[model samples]
Target chain A: MTDTEKVIEIQVLRYRPEQETEPVLQSFKVPFTDDMSVLQGLQYIKDYLDGTVSFRWSCRMAICGSCGMMIDGKPKLSCKTFLREYYPAGLRIEALAHMPIERDLIVDAGDFITKLESIKPYIIPKEPRTLEQGEYLQTPQQRDMYEQFSSCINCMLCYAACPQYGLDKTFTGPGVLALMHRYNADSRDGASAERMDLGYAHEGFWGCTAVGYCSVVCPKGVDPANAINQNKMNSAINYFTRFVTPKGGTK
Target chain B: MSKRRPYVRSMDGWWKRDAYFVKYMAREVTAVFVAAYAVVLLVGLVRLAQGQAAYEGWLAALKSPLSLVFHLVLLATFVYHTWSWFNIMPKTMPIMFVGGKRVQPGMITGAGLAAAVVACLAVLLIVRGVAS
Candidate 1:
């Protein structure tokens, strides 16, 4: 709103189902403060320049995991990415890669939600615990077994960074795989046998070629590639054991 | 009906656009060298089965300048494969705790590399002893 306010051009991909056949880049000049984030920059454009330019965002602090977008062609949380860093060079904002773009800067996340649900994200108790038995207890060491994988917020940036998922949607993908590992690694959980069926499948961990971009792009440090690759080893061992195990012992 | 036509992007050749992906592709390409080395060894074994004269001819071909160049290239790729393999090995394994603290990935990679060097040296010593 001031004469000296620094202005930067943000080239955002716009897609309107009623109008355009495909997404196209639409440029907007946004005046931003040094502390302003990319999400704030988009908000400024929506409030002042164009009300129609739509994007998803919630907690502005990267925790909500709703503000993921491709900033300069890399998957990133728009809320966590500062506008000042990309200043002078500006930035190109687009929907997360691989997934279908539902609208401007918004990818259809229905597939991800479905995959997340399929993993059985909740802990299936090893032993039925009654109210009198009290809440299930866990040692610090037990918590550490799955703590790293538990940090995934379902942002799907790992999915965006994954070429395997982009090539084949049938692949279980990274974020969901990490969530699967989280429950499996938990000591109190007895669903490992059930989850191993999915993990050992051809469409599961075998789909990942270990391109490793997933871990690098993950904002939560969830390292879904680690989870997926470790499961690949488990799958490999299980694969060899299936032939040797007693007839009815194998799944 | 809902007005929704979600646009899907192509993944084919997408790695060509990024340096990170290019490096990853290069690492993957190293597998060709491993396969080639295996094939060459298999040919040597076949030549040995054919008799001493055939084995000598096979060894002579390996000593040629072109084959030496291939060997050099294979060596470089082998080095890269070893380094990258150890770098990722820590991630693919469960966390190792020593003294109740998780071992660092860098430390794990360093240990793996050290083990590889010691094994190579032991192999070299055994080969030298056999030649003597």
Candidate 2:
């Protein structure tokens, strides 16, 4: 494409902690094609125009779960966001919402990782399995139960759309909750009790205000809001059952 | 002296302090508002059933400035509750698949709100006819 056809103006929020205290909007006119993604546009600017621009990307396709950024005030995967969607007019891009920007497009993900760990996101068998037993048997119906939640790529787009996640950094947001549901719904997993302690806490299941934006922003159709709300019901049942059952009951 | 590993009480001071917890907390808070509204309406109905004078007294109480302001607040919360409830209805219910296509959330919420409005109008018409 020629310069006139290739040129696409993109406004980016720039922040460098080492040099600058706050973020500022910087515009760049770059050569772009209809086939290219927003990530490619940024790459072009980095390779040709300016090296100071910072962002993250991996897998270039939508699978790696990196390259999540705010495009026109919405959390989206830059690699998946097509330039054709915002052609003729320039576009505005920024770091994901609700998180402190480390530099240009990179936001702190430590809180997200910590929340994931808090949920005990691993399978625990109901009974100890012997190696001779081979893999635990599961029917198609059982696999279908939690298959949707297993699609979560940990993209964190849901976290950006979630105002609750913005207000409270430690609240274990949607991404982690979806992961927790993945394990909890597993037929082989018996760690529901161990995980419920975290899910039932004041800030755990109860903290979700159910804005429903998390499900809207999820790229992989992993309805995190549903997972969290279902857990809320589970937490309520567990709360009442503890008094009625002896030996702490069974899952 | 024994060395103590610094342990953060994850549950302590969680409300409003943690974003992840706040979303669920907000939902619970809204539930309380819904329950309060239900109880208030139920009490009004009970008074109406007792006698005309008792029903009139309930109406008078509602007309009071404090009660009016409280009702206004309740109305706002009720609207919020209704909207949020409809938004989440799709998640709990089985997906409506027609012609091998899943129904959208917007369609569900729109239909629910429309039904609620129609139901409210029907109630108002019935009450007006009964009063006459």
Candidate 3:
């Protein structure tokens, strides 16, 4: 409790089942150093200011992808965002945008999880490999096809930043679509025909209007916009080539 | 335990909240001018078929100050429309590989813009040669 210490104001949107009808912002002034992250500021509020404030965070580093929130109306990883950036102006933190707030600073990610699973994030082999067979090897060029899209940590920030998803929750969304492209583009994966069914569907990659904020807000630089848009071209070609090619162009 | 009610916020006027959305909307709006210019050309083609008197009247209409201002606005929107279309084309198109190296996004935009400039110049030269 020193008078000389520098403090920053953090406004968190709080939701309680019994107390509030809807989420509302509550302001708190907390002392912060240059190194204090937005996640740490939320921690200070929970630790001292209010015990009820809830958020999800793991791996204090940015790898966990859990501490995502709408910081000043932008989707960001709170753990990676420092409080010093908004020292004088202060920050209004809310649960991730375009989602139902389950509680204070925590949104319902059930929809996101379902979308992730629907895409089948794992790789399906073209053919089963016998124990005697060697590992599936790919050239450097082959890896480059799907390399940049493989970095999604599923933080759901892309979902929050996506206006299409915000307007219509049915859109397959950026992160999951990027992950879908990651698996589909893999040299050894032979499930492109299957994934393209979902990719070309009305609610799939076609859902994106290409606002492109998904790439800008992404902490991992996964470029989900690029992945989804590339598939738009692929899907269109697949439609035209279904007659000419027996397997179609999804492969 | 009591029931839980999750508050889903309304997303009204969502595009107005971000500058990116404004830019995207602006890009989309250029299509209006594109359609307008197409209409102008269509009317011109119809006037040409109607006979010389009607074609001369259309030519006179094009020489009006109001039409000049309209054409100027059309030029600006067409430029922006072309730049934005090619600017986003790389993302919309499949990844390109040349000489075992991936083509850079900037290169794609640059190539597209260069091609557009070349095409415009060729059209200008051909129009001049035809007029001469």
Candidate 4:
């Protein structure tokens, strides 16, 4: 609003179910500081320009993983990505690729949520330890197995980046599979054999063609590609050794 | 049924949209050249079993300039295949832990490529030994 203040163009993909049949790019010019994020630009648009602009955000610090969108054809957290990076030029924002757009910059995350729950993102101890049995202890060495994979924030940015998921929604894409790997790699968890059944399915680890773009777009450094591909080897081994080892081989 | 219509974006030519995807497609297409090389070797093997005259004909074909060009193309594709195969080895394989620390992905790729070079050299030496 000042003379010295600079303005930037933000092109947002708008999709209102009642008003518009399909998503359309709507442009807005907003004044912003260097430290302002792309999320803040959207906030400015909502506050002054257009109130109908709908998007999800909470914590606004990348932990909630809600404000994920395609910023210039790349899946990134709008909260973490600064507006200065794409300033002066036209900054195009769209709902995450390969997902059904619910509204402006909001994709339907129902599929991702369902897949997350289906993977059972918690440990199922072999023998249920009661309160009397103290805690399930894990050494630093054992923790190293699943440490890298455990950092996933359930942001579906990796899903947005994955082509296989775009081609086939049935495939248990990157984030959920990585979370499944997290629980499976736990030393105290005995349900890896159970989880391996899901991993062994056609829509599981085998579905991944190792494009590896999932890891590149990850904000949490989750390396979902490594998780999925590693399980592919595990699935291959289980398929080969199933006859010899009883109970479908060890996890 | 609910009356909610969500717009799903068309992913047509999505691979062409990103350079990373184009690289992946290129890597996948290398398999065709690898299969071609296999077929060439198979043809040579079949000719050897047919007769001495047929075997000599195959060898003469290999000496042609066109065949040399084809071989050069094959070599180029094979080199790319070898590099990409090792580059992705760390991701496809299980994570390596050394002395309670995780092994670096670069180290894994470098080691795989080195092993592949050694194996290729061994195969060449064995083929030379068989010839002389």
Candidate number with greatest DockQ: 1
lDDT of 1 by residue, B1-132 (tens): 999999987777898856778988888999999999999999999999999999999999999999999999999999898888888887787777899998877898999999888988999999999999
lDDT of 1 by residue, A57-168 (tens): 9998888899999999999999999999998989999999999999988899999998888878898989878989897889898888899899988899998898889989
DockQ of candidate 1 against the true complex: 0.72
Fnat across every predicted model, in order: 0.67, 0.07, 0.67, 0.70
Backbone Cα, N, C clashes tallied per candidate: 0, 14, 0, 0
In model 1 chain A, the worst 10-residue window by lDDT is: A242-251
- What's the true lDDT of residue A132 in model 4? 92
DockQ value for model 3:
0.70
Which should have the higher TM-score, number 2 or number 4?
4
Best by lDDT: 4
lDDT of 4 by residue, A186-220 (tens): 89888988787788998899889999999999998
lDDT of 1 at A39: 95
Off by over 4 Å in 4: A248-251, B1-3, B129-132
C-alpha DockQ of every model: 0.72, 0.13, 0.70, 0.71
Q: Clashing pairs in model 3?
A: none
Better of 1 and 3 by lDDT: 3
Q: Candidate 3: where is the Cα deviation over 4 Å? A: A1-4, A248-251
Tens digits of per-residue lDDT for model 2 on A136-249? Answer: 999866776677889999889998877666667668888888888889889999998888777887667677876777887788888888888877767777788877878554
Q: Can you list the residue pairs that collide in candidate 1?
A: none
The lDDT for every candidate, in the order shown, is: 0.89, 0.80, 0.90, 0.91
> Candidate 1 overall Cα lDDT vs. reference?
0.89
